[model samples]
Target: MLRFNKWSLTPFHLLTLLLTLTLTLWLLNVCFNLPTWLLLVPIALIQFLSFLFFHTIKEKGNIAVVYYCGYALVIFLLFKWFNSMAITSLTYTQWLGSFMMVPQPVFAYFLSSTLMLSSMFIALIYYFVIIHFRPMVLILISALPATICIRMGRPTVSSYLFIFMGILLLLYMYYCSYEAEELPYTVLPCTKSYWSTMSLLLLCIFLTCSLLLIPGSNLSNPIHTLLRTQVTNHLQPNYTTSTLPKESTATSAPTALSDTPIFEVRATKPVYFRTRGWDYYEKNAWHVKREALSLGYQLPKSEMNQKLEQKSLVLLNVIERLEKNGLLQDMPELTHLLEAPISPITYYAAYVTTLNYSHYMYLNPPGLISISNPFSPLDLYLNALEICFANDKTRPYPNEGYVISYMDTFPASNSREMLLIESLDPSTYNQLINFLLDRVWEQHNLQQAQEDEYFLKKCSDEMETATLHFLDIPNSITKRTYDLAQKITASSTSTYEKALAIQNYFYNGEFTYDLNSPVTPLDKDAIEYFLFESKRGTCVQFASAMTMLCRAAGIPTRYMEGYVCEEYDASKGCYIIKQKHAHAFPEVYLPGYGWRIFEPTIPATENEKSPLSLILLLITCLMFLFILYFLSKVLSEQLWRLWIVRQEPKIALEAIYSRLLKRLKKNGYVIEVSMTPINISHILLEQGIDLTWLTEHYCKVHYGHCSCDKTVVLQALQLYKFLYHVHP
Candidate 1:
C-alpha cells in the first residue's frame, strides 16, 4: 500500500487539476458546440472522483483507475457519434454534404479529443517510466489546443488563455520543485498565499479580456494590415468568380466603398493592369488548363534606344526600393523571349503600390525588357499572347510596392491588309489566299520540326503547342452559340469584320449591364444563358459571351482579368487603383497581329453614396474610438498600481503586510492587524521563518520618526520572498 501525506492534496495540486479540467471543458464547448453546463457536470464529477480515488487508493488500484477512465471516455465518444441519426444514415454524397455543414465543430471535436488522449497517455507514461509526473508535459500539451484553434481558422482569446495558463502552471510547478529540494517537508504555498494566487488569476483574466477587445479577435487585426497585406489576400486565391463577374467577384458589393488605396501606378500614359488571362470557360467560371513552368532570369540586352534605356534606369531605381523593402526579388524568364522570336518596341516604367496576385501585371504584348526587382524565379505558362506567372513562392510580397520596365510590341503592320482579302476581286483574293496558304504550309513544317526538337530537348510542351490550345474550345458549347455567331456576322466578310460585328452586337444596347442580377441556372450553360436567354449580366457574362462568339466565328480569343486605369490621381501624378477598378475583358486573336483588346460591355454607373451609409460609417468610427478608450483605461489602472508601489514605500509595505495577514488567515493562522509586528513574527516563527529583524525595520519606517533606508527595504523584500515560499 502507498501512504499518502496530508500535503499531497495541496492547494497547488487542486488548482492545477481544476485548470486542466477547465481547459478540457472549454475546448469541448468551443469545438463541439457543447453546452457549458452539460460539460461542467460530467467534468466536475470525473475530476472529483479522480481526486478522491487518487488520495484513497493504494498503488495496486492505479491500473484499474486508468483502464476505467479510458474505457469511459471511449464509450462517451461512441455514444455521441451514434446519437446523430442524420450522420449515421448519410450516403457518401450525403455524408460529404453533412461533413461540410459541420466541418468546424467536427474538426474541433477531433482536435480536442486528440489533445485529451495525448495528454493522458503522456502523463501515464511519465508516471510509470520515470516514477514522477512532470508538469512540463502540460507545456507540450498546450501546443495541441493552439494548433487546433489556428486550424479551425484563427486563434481565439480562450486559446491564448489556455496557453498562458499552461505557462503559469509550469512556472508554479518549477517553483514547487525547487522548494521541495530546499525543504522536503514543506507543503505547496499556492493555497497559503491566497492573495497572490487571486491576484495572478485576476491578471490573467484582464490580459485575456484585453485580447478580446482587439478587432477581428483571431482574424486580421489593425496591426496586421499595418505590418503586411490584408489577411484575405494571403489565404484566398488571387482570382475569384461572382454570379455577376462584371460588378464584383465577392458574394455581394460592400455596403460602403472603402477609400483604402490599393496601389499607385506611375506611367506616362495610364494602361490596363493585366494580372491573369483565362482560356477555358465552363459553368459560369473561367479556368486555366496548363500548368506554369519555372524559368529563371534571362539577361536582357543593355544596348537599346536612348529613351527606352533611360526609362529602364528609372524603373531599376524603383525596383531597388521594392527589393530593399523585401517586395520583389528576381525577374522571370519568358518562353517567347527565350525560345520564340520576338521584336522589341518602346520601353516604359511603372511604379505599382500593392501586389494582390502572384503574377506581374503588364500591358499586353510585352517584349524583352529588363525588370528592376525580379521575381525570386519565375514560372511561365505560355499560351499565345497570354503569359502568366504560376510560382507563388517567387511572387511579389503582398502589400509591398514594385516598379518594372517593360517593352511593348505591336502586331505586323500588314495585319489589316490580310483582313482586307474579302473586299478584293476574285482573282486577287484567290491569288493572295494561295500565297498565304503556301507560306502557312512552309511555316507549319518548320514549327513541326521545332516542336519535335522542343519535345526531345524536354522543353515546355504548352509553349510549343500554344496555337493549338488557343483554337481549342470545350465540346459542351451548344449549337445556339454557332447559330448566333453566324447570324450576327452574316453580313461580315473578313475575320476582323466578324469580330467587329460580334463586339457591336453586345454594345448595341441589346443586353443590360446589371451587377445585382440573379445567378444563371446551373443546368443551362453560363455563356449560352447570358447571350440568348438572360441578356443582363456583368463583365464576366459579357466577356464569356464575346469569347465564345468569336471562337464560333473562327476567331481565337482568350478571357482576361485585370484593372482598368480609369481613375487617375492628379495629386500623386499617377493612377490610384482600387478594388472597384477590377475588371474582366476578352482579347481577340488576329492571325498576323497578336491578341487585341475589344470592350463588349458598357461602362457601369458609379453607385451614389446614401445618407444611411454615411451614418453607419460615422457610428463605426465612434465605436472604434470607444474600444481604444476602454483599452487605455484598463492599461492605465495597471500602471497606476505600479506607480503607487514605487512612489510610496511605507504605503507599499503596509499593503504587502495586509496581504500577508490575509494569506496567514487562509492558512489557518489567526492573524490580526491589532497585533504588533513582534507578535506576528512570534507566530511566523512556528512556521520556521525568522521575521524579527524585518518587523523591527517595518516599525522604524512606519511607527518611528526615522526615514526608510535601502537596508530596511532590502530586508522587507527578503522577508517577503521567504514568506512567499512558506507553506501552511
Candidate 2:
C-alpha cells in the first residue's frame, strides 16, 4: 500500500548508517589521533532522521515547544552520561588509556554532543531575540560577528565553531526570508513563516556545529607518545637481565648492589631509623592512617636525642625515563617533594638532562651513608641495618619468597632495648610499637595468647566536640567568591586554616580539568556555575575565596587587586615577585607565627600555579553577566510597550486610558493583553492611580451608554500625568 521514493533511504538504512558512521569515526580517531571529525557523521544522519520523523508528524502552537524541550532533555542527559566517562586529554589517555581506551569513545561521543548542544542553544537564543525584536536580518547578522569580536576577542575553538555554524544557518534563514518574500505562502503575507523557518534552520546548524567542534585539542597530541610507550612496554618488559628470571628452581645469584650495607651512627647510644611504616594494603598501594593524639602519653626526655646533628639534605634532580619512575633520584620515603609536577616526564627536564623513554640513567645510585644519631655510640651502630636505594640488579636466577627483605634482629644492640610505643588508641596508630608488637602477638597467637585488651576492659575512651564557624559578608556580592571558598575548605577547620586550605586547593586543583573550556548547553548553569557552583574555580574565583575565607576565619585576608608585576617593584623589593597577572593572598595567623601567605586563585592543575589578575578577571565576569542579563530583558515585548506608553498620554479619554493601561506594566501591573476598555479603567483605578476622569468617561460610554468624547480623553491625560508624576 506504501509508495517508496527512489532517492529516499528507509529507517533501517539510516539506523545502520548511524551505527557504522559512529564506529568508523571512533576507530579512526583512536588509530590516527585525529579530532574525531567523523563523529559528526552519525550525529548529522540522526538529526536528519529526527527531522524526517518530525516531518511526518504535525505540531501546532505551543506543542512544538514541548517537542523541542523533550529533544533537548534527552540529548543533554545522554551527553552527560557519556561525558562522565569520556577521556578529555591526550596525556591522560596515554598514561591511563593504554590499558583501556573505553573512556575515549565516551569522551568522543560527549565532546561531539556537547558542542552540538551548545551551538543549538546559542542559535535558539539568537532566534528568540530575532523573533521578539524582528530586527533587520542583515543588521543581526552583522551584529553577531561585531559583538563577538567586541565582547570576546580572539574567539575560542568552541565559540568559533558555534559562530561559524550559527552564521551559516543565519544565511540560510536570510535565503528563506528572501524566498518567502518572492513567493508568499499566504494571502495576507507576513515574514513570520520566513523568520520561523530561519530560526529552526539556525538551531539545527548550531546543534550540528556543537557536535562537531567540541573536545580534544592539539595540545593533547603529545600524550599519544605516552600511550604508545605504555603499549610497547606491556608487550616487552624493560627490566635489566639481573631482574629477569633465569630458571624455575635454581638459587638466584646476587649482583654488586644486591647485598645489604650497614652504616655506623655517631650517637652516644643506639637509635632506631625511621623508615616508612605501612598500615593498610589494598590494590598494591600503601595508605597511612591518621595518628591519634594522646594528652596523657608524652615522649620521655631520655628518648629525645638532645645531641646536635647536621646532615645536608642531598637533592637528586631526576628526569624520569620510564613511567613507573618518579622525579626523585631514589625512592626515599621520608623526602618531601617540592614543586612536584603533575606530569613527571614534562617537569623533570627542569632539574636534570632529559633522557629518551628507552634510556636508563640513575643520577644517584643506591647506597648507604653514615648518619649521626643523638643516642647510640658510633661504633655500637656501625653495622646497623638501614634502607638503601638499588636498581634491583639481583635475582639473576629463580627467586621465591619475596623480592625485598628486612633485618631479623637489631644489628648491634639487644632487640629488647628498642623502645615500646605507648598510645591510648593503639588500634588507630597501627604503626607505633604495633609493627614489632604485631609480629610478637602473631607468634604468641600460634602458642595460645592472653586476653584481648578491649575484651578485657583495659581500653579507655575520650571524645571531642565539633565546632563550626563561617565569616559572613554583607550583601550577595560575596556569595560567588565565598561559595567557592566554602567548597575548597569544606574539609578545613578555622577560617585561617580554610583560607590557607582554599588557597592551597586552587594552587593544587586544576587549570584545565578538561583541555578546553567549551561553552555548554542551556542546561549548563552559565559561567557563574563554573565560578561558584562547581568551585574548581578559575584563578580569580580561587584567589577571591582564599582572601574572603581567611578574613572570615579571623585571619587577615586581602584582595591583591592589581596587574601582575610583570617586573619587580622599582626599589627595595626583596623577593622580586615577578607577577604577570592579578592574584590574591591570605595572610593567616599561626598562633606564634605572625602571618603566612596563602594563594587560592591558582588554576587547579598539577603543574599550573595561580596567576598574579584573578580579582580583576572575576569582577569583569560579574559585570559581564550582569550586563548580558540586563540587555537580554531590555527589549522584551512588555518592556518595549512599557517604554512607549510611559511617554505622556496627550490623547482623548479612551486613548489616554488605553495608554495608561500599557504603561502600568512599569509598576508590575499586568493589564492583560486583551483587557476590555472597562476592565482597563477598573485596573488603573484599583492600582491607586488617579484615573477619576477616565473612569467617569468609561462609565458614561460603556454603561450609561453615552458616546466617547475628546474632552474626557484630554482630562484623562491630565489625570494620568498627575497620578504618574505626583504619586507614582
Instruction: Compare the candidates by lDDT and give the number of the best one.
Output: 1
Candidate-wise lDDT, in order: 0.49, 0.32
Task: State TM-scores per candidate.
Answer: 0.41, 0.22
lDDT string, candidate 2, 1-728, tens digits: 12224345544224323332333333333232334553465545554554444333323446866776776676667665655655555443353333221223334544544345333433343333322323333334434433532221212223434444454444333333333233321122234544554465456545444432322211111122211211122211222112211111101111011000011111122122221111221221112222221011111111111110000010111111111233233423212222232211110010111101121111110111222112111211110011111223311111010111111111112111111111112232223123223322333233322332221121111101001111223332345545655566677554334544655554453433321233323443323334444544333334444444554444433322221222222221211111122222233432211123344444335543222123334544665575456446534633544543554333244455565665667657767778765576577678765555566676676566676544555555556654443323
> What are the runs in model 1 whose C-alpha is more than 4 Å off?
1-260, 289-346, 355-370, 374-385, 390-393, 399-402, 407-467, 473-476, 608-728
Instruction: Specify the poorest-scoring 10-residue window by lDDT in model 2.
Output: 306-315
Cα lDDT of model 1 by residue, 38-76, tens digit: 556556555555555444433545575776577558645
Counting clashing residue pairs in each candidate, in order, gives 5, 29
